[model samples]
Target chain A: MTFIDMLGAAERQNHSMLCVGLDPEPARFPGRLAGDASKIYDFCAAIVDATADLVIAFKPQIAYFAAHRAEDQLERLMAHMRRVAPQVPVILDAKRGDIGSTAEQYAIEAFERYGADAVTLSPFMGFDSVAPYLKYHGKGSFLLCRTSNPGGDDLQNQRLASVDGQPLLYEHIARLAQGPWNLNGQLGLVVGATYPAEIERVRAVAPTLPLLIPGVGAQGGDAAATVRAGWRPGAPIIVNSSRAIIYASSGDDFADAARREALRTRDVLQAARADSLRVATP
Target chain B: MTFIDMLGAAERQNHSMLCVGLDPEPARFPGRLAGDASKIYDFCAAIVDATADLVIAFKPQIAYFAAHRAEDQLERLMAHMRRVAPQVPVILDAKRGDIGSTAEQYAIEAFERYGADAVTLSPFMGFDSVAPYLKYHGKGSFLLCRTSNPGGDDLQNQRLASVDGQPLLYEHIARLAQGPWNLNGQLGLVVGATYPAEIERVRAVAPTLPLLIPGVGAQGGDAAATVRAGWRPGAPIIVNSSRAIIYASSGDDFADAARREALRTRDVLQAARADSLRVATP
Candidate 1:
């Protein structure tokens, strides 16, 4: 199935918008897995097993695995995710950006090597950097719009001198992803959940495109506000939570605790979606 | 020594502004090595050994290795560079950009794990993303400013609305790299060799910062113009040529041919520097 089709199917099947971000920290792994980089797959796989039905998608942050020379484990984890929870789409949170042939190689890494359903990318290098990923027909890619980080303001919030209107940099990125850049209907924008107003603005601009909204749990974004601002009847919002869910407990019940947190967050998001729909209909 | 110190020492020792970019594609590998992903280390090591003394820096694009799942090979190649040519610094051309702990993980992947002297990063996420790399004390990073790709104009060339003269996106990045963002003097800018006038403009804004200028060889960026626009007395410009030098031959004499290509390119860049200096002085 195409990535968007998978997202919609997973959302309907799971009845959730929660995307559990698998940003595994070996040092933070509980009990026997603590400080063991080799068990990255085991830790992440357990979380995936516990929360597969609870999440609309699974997001794995590449740096967390690569940092500990655990790419093989990541490959294994990706395989496990596909085998166990094929219904849920996996977004590789790589944020990779380059040009031409090099960008092609990265596309191979994310799609062929890791077998990710979608990959997150940085939009700094513009269309050519992004164009390479679009060549992979059914796969999806998200451009970093208004990120949750405070430093995101250093560029994303700046006003652009466009003849039509002086739109903010993120707004320009949103419009591009919504219009000219979405050639294959595989484009999406990563709007951080921390900025609900910005999320609203992006939703207005890119009404139909899916939004990967991170920063909900530990990053302190209000789940209800994020859903309220970003959700629409046809549009989708994949709200991500990494640390707060994965590290819900420091003891041996880490996987169980993660499941509990995932369940809670997923329900909260579902409730928010229902409230948003009710208000919109009224 | 610090990364900048290694850069200066290598530039003086080699009398070259040329940086040999190690972007190994197995399909493009020479003779018996062709189509063998396992020989990535052997292929890259041969190139590094051949042109070690002809370069100011050795840039190994991470995507090329990671695409083939040859990151372990990259680790070995990094060790090989240190063993064979300790004077020439290695820049892991990752172009990684993230925030918070994820950024720290990437820093670890580049600095501690790979043992790279420097890394390339995308400045799209702003300061917090770039900040983690700076915490590595002596290590250096080049932020993508005006890239060589045609799509670079999509955003990098856009005018930013400010109280002062409306600077293009790239100029704002240059100013930031020159000023507040460059904590510990460990930052540089990646301005494409294809855009000589843009390089000159960047140099004008950030007079003393090091510039990693890629795009010379196969990409058809003019070497002399690149050197003339970017080269200045103490402010080093690393002119990179990857495919042309590395794939100079498809025969048994590939390494020797690579050395010849690297030597020829090095001399061309050195001559350009001398001509630029002569013009400046006259």
Candidate 2:
């Protein structure tokens, strides 16, 4: 199935929009699993086994694995994802941006080598930089629109001249993204949950585009406001929470705590969906 | 020595600002070195040995090696660079960008793992994304400004609104880079030789910032115009030429051909330096 269809299926089967971020920092991992690739793999596998049914997707930030010289850690992580949760999507949160040829190699690395169902991309290099990845009909590409960090407004919010003489940066991206290059409909936008107004504005421009909303839990962003600003009638949205869910407990029962946190977030997401449906019906 | 001092020494020692790019494509390799990692290493080592004293530095585009899953290729490539020309700096052409935590990991991978003197970075994720790398006091970070590709103008040329209410995307990056964050003075900018006017504008904004000029030969960029635009009076500048130098010949004498092309480019850069000195004196 295509990425969109797979997302729809995952949303229905799991009954949640929560995307668990599997960003395993070596410094923060349980002491028992520290300093060994095999032990880290086991820890990640246990978490996947416990929470496969509670969320729509899993996002493994590539840098966390890449930081250590774990040669085959990425491949092993993808294998664990496929074995435990075949229906749920695995998004490789690698914000890669390069020229056309290099971008093609990165696409192969994310899709063929690691088997990511979707990958995040940096859109600063222009549309052609991302066009090669979007050519993959079965995979999805999430463009960085507004990030979650404190310095995100540095350049992303810079006002430029739109074709119609308005605020340019994100609107330019929105206009181009909604235009000809999205023929496969596998495009998504990354709008940080911290900026509710920007999320609403982005939604108004590209209402049909799926959004990957980050920065919800530990980042102090309100989940209710995010769902209210970002939710579409029946469109796809994946609300990701990383530190709050994964590191809920550093003890041996960490996996259990992760599952509990994931369940709580799922319940909240389901209630938000119900409220969004009510508003749409009214 | 720091990256700035090394650049100054290379320019003075070689009497040239040319930086030969080592972008080795497997298909373009010599007959004996076809499709093998060891042979590729030998070929690159031979080229470095032949051309080390003729140019300012060597730039190896990371994507070419990454494309072929040649196990331990990057390690071998760095080993070859160290052995062939210990004095010449190696600039890794990997345009990586991400969050602060993730960027730190990449910095470790590039400087610690690969032993590169400098690495290219994309500034799309904002300042925090690059701050981790800049923390390495002795290493160099080249932020992408105006690229040489055809579609680069799409975003890089967009007129952004500044606090002074002027056109300001590249200008904003220049102004922000001048603050305390760049204390080590190891920061540089990557502006394409194809956009000489933009290069001049960027230089006018940040006069002391070193510049890495790519797109010289095969990309049809004017070498003289770029030298005129960016050459400071007896200061550091690296003019990179990849395909034109590396693939100068597809025969058994490929390494020799590469050395010859590098020599020619080096001569042109020396002449430009001479002209800059004359202009300064007048």
Candidate 3:
């Protein structure tokens, strides 16, 4: 099945818009597992097993694995996720950007090697960097639009002088992802949850594209505000919470704590969706 | 030693500005080694051994390694380059971009794990994303300013509405890299060899910063024009050629052929530097 189909299925099956981000820092692992890079797969698998039924998707940040030379472990984790949670989509949060042949290599790494349902990309290199990922007809690619950081204003907020009208850089990215760049109709935008106002602006421009909203947890983005701004009737918003969910506890009950946090955040987003629908109907 | 110090030393030691990119594609591997992903380290090590003394730097494209699950081989190659050509700097061409903690993880992945002298990054997320890498003191970071791809014009060429004056997106990046954002005085810019005029414009904006100019051979960038536009007495320009050098032959003498190609390209860049100097003197 296509990534969008998997996303919609997981969203309905689990009744969630929440996406748990697995950014495993060995130093941050719980108790016995702490500082053991070899246990990366073990630590991440527990979190996946605990929260698999509570999230619309799972995002595994590549750096976390590569930093510890645990890429082989990541391969095993990818297989574990596939076996355990076949219904949920997996977004390999790589944010890779390159051109032509190199870009194709990255596409192969993300889709073919990792078997990811979708992947994230940086739009700094433009169309050709993005086009290669679209070739994997069923997979989805989320372009970094308005990221969840103070530094995002440095380039993303700058106004672009266009013949038609002056639109901010992020706005132009939104329009492109929602229009011409959505070649396989599986394109998405990564709008940080910290910027609810900008999230609303992006939704206004794109309308239908799935929005992978990060920063709702440890980054101080309000989960309710994110859903209010991004959620539409048929549209999807995979609101991600990394540290807030995965690192919810430092004790042996870490996986349980993670599940608790995921469930809480998911309910909060669902409540906001209902409120958003009510306000829109009125 | 600082990355800048190493770069200067390598340029003088090799007496060349050419950077041989190790973008190994197994399907294109020579004869007996053809379609064998396991030979990534072997193929790249041969090229490195052949051209180590003829070039200023060595760039290993990480995607090419990761695509074939050859990251372990890449690690071995990194060690091999350090041992065989310790004078030359290695640029991990990852083009990674993210914010805060995740960016920090990527920084560790590139610097500590890979032991690279420098790494390429997309500056779309701005200062915070770039800042983590600078914390490594002497290590260098090259921000994607004006990439060497046709799709680059989509975003890099657009004029940005700024308070001082309107500048293209790439110009803004150049100004930032050359000025405030270049913390620790170790930041550089990646400008394509294909757009010689843009290279000149970027050089004018950031006179002292090193420019990693890709697109030379296989991508159709003119070496002479690239040097004329980017090279200066104090600043260095790393002219990169990947396929044209590494895959110079499909025979048993592949390494020898790679060395010949590297020698030819290195001399062309060296000749251009003299021409540029003579023209400037008159």
Candidate 4:
């Protein structure tokens, strides 16, 4: 199935919209999992097992595993996702962009090698960088729209000279996502939850596209406000919470804590969506 | 010494401006060196040993190594650069970007783990993402400005609403590199050789900063035009060629062929720079 259909099935099955980010820092992992490859595997494995039913997707930040040279651990995580929670998609948050040939290598690495259902991309190099990734019709690619960082405003928020109207640089990108740049129908945008107004702007342009909204947790984004601004009535929106859910605690109860946090966020997202629907109808 | 200083010393001594790209692929290696870790290591080792003195920098595109799960091979390439061509800096062409914390992990991956003297960065997420990589005082970060692809025009070339005289997106990024964004004076821009006009535009703005110009060989970039457009006398600019140089021949003489191709590109670049210098003089 296509990534959208896969996501739809999972959302309907679980009645949730939570995406748990697996950004495992060795220092932040529990004491038992420190300095051991097997332990790292077990930590992620248990977390996945504990929370598989509570969420729609799992985001594995590529840098966290790659920092420790634990690509194997990430591969194992992908394997576990397939074996246990095949319905829930795995989005690899790599944010990589490069020239076409090099991007082709990354495409194989992300999809063919690591088996990610979706991958986050940086749109700096423009369409050629994204083209190789888009060829995988079965998968999905989320381009950075308005990022959720203080420094993000530096470039992405620049006002572009009028084409049809005086839109910000990110708006131009959103239009492109809804335009020719999006060759396949599997394209989405990553509008950080910290900037709900920007999310609303993006939502208006790309009405039906899936949006991977991060920054709702540790980044200090108001979750309810973000959901209200980000949700499209029947759209597939995955709100990601990495640190808040995955590292909910560093003790032996880490897995259980992760499940509890994910469950809570899932419910909150559902409630916010319901409220937004009511407002729209009334 | 900074990456600029190292590259400058090499350029002045070698009288060459070519930067060889070491994007090794295992399947393309000589028949003898196949199906082993030693094959991947040997391919890069042989190429570097042959071309170390012919060029001022060696750019190992991280995806080429990471795709094959030969990150250790990449580590070996970095080590080999330090040991053999200590005067020549290695630019880790990862083109990585993310939010601050994730950027920190990537910074550690490139600078701390791989020990690269410089890295290529995607400017999509703006300052905070680039900030972590820039924290390495001794290292250099080459921000993507105008990439060498048809699809690059989709975003980087958009005319920004005049914050500073209606400059294009890439130009704004270059001006930012010269102004407040370049904290420690080690920032550079990647203006692809394919777009000589954009290269000239970036060079005109960031006069003294290094420009990592790719697309010189297989990407249909005019080497002479690029050298003329990109060269700033007494500036440390690098022109990169990957597939054309590294995979020049899949035969047993691959390393030798690569050296010959690199030496030729180096000489042509030198001739172009000298002509430009003569024009500027009298």
| TM values, all candidates | 0.99, 0.94, 0.99, 0.97
- Candidate 2, which segments miss by more than 4 Å at Cα? B37-40, B179-181
- How far off is residue A98 in model 4, in Å? 1.2
CAPRI tier for the interface of model 2? medium
Question: Chain A: TM-score in each candidate?
Answer: 0.99, 0.96, 0.99, 0.97
Give the winner by lDDT: 2 or 4: 4
Candidate 1 local distance difference test against the native:
0.94
Worst 10 residues of 4 chain B by lDDT: B29-38
Segments in model 4 whose C-alpha atoms lie over 4 Å from true places: A34-38, B30-38
lDDT for B264 (candidate 1): 94
TM-score of chain B of each: 0.99, 0.94, 0.99, 0.96
* lDDT tens per residue, model 2, B172-260: 67666655447667888888888788888888877888889998999888888888889886436789988888878888788899889
Question: Compared to the true structure, candidate 3 yields what TM-score?
Answer: 0.99
- Candidate 2 accuracy as lDDT: 0.80
Model 4 TM-score, all chains together:
0.97
lDDT of 4: 0.85
> DockQ for all models, in order?
0.90, 0.62, 0.88, 0.77
- For all predictions, the C-alpha RMSD in Å is 0.9, 2.1, 0.9, 1.7
- Give the distance in Å from residue A256's predicted Cα in candidate 3 to where it truly belongs: 1.2
lDDT of 1 by residue, B1-282 (tens): 999999999999999899999999999999999999999999999999888888999999999999999989999999999999999999999999999999999999999999999999999999999999999999999999999788898888889996268899999999999999999798999999887999999999999999999999998999999999999999999999999999999987899999999999999999998898889899
What range of 10 consecutive residues in model 2 chain A has the weakest lDDT sum?
A161-170
Model 4 steric clash pairs: A161-B161
Give the fraction of native contacts in model 1: 0.90
lDDT of 3: 0.94
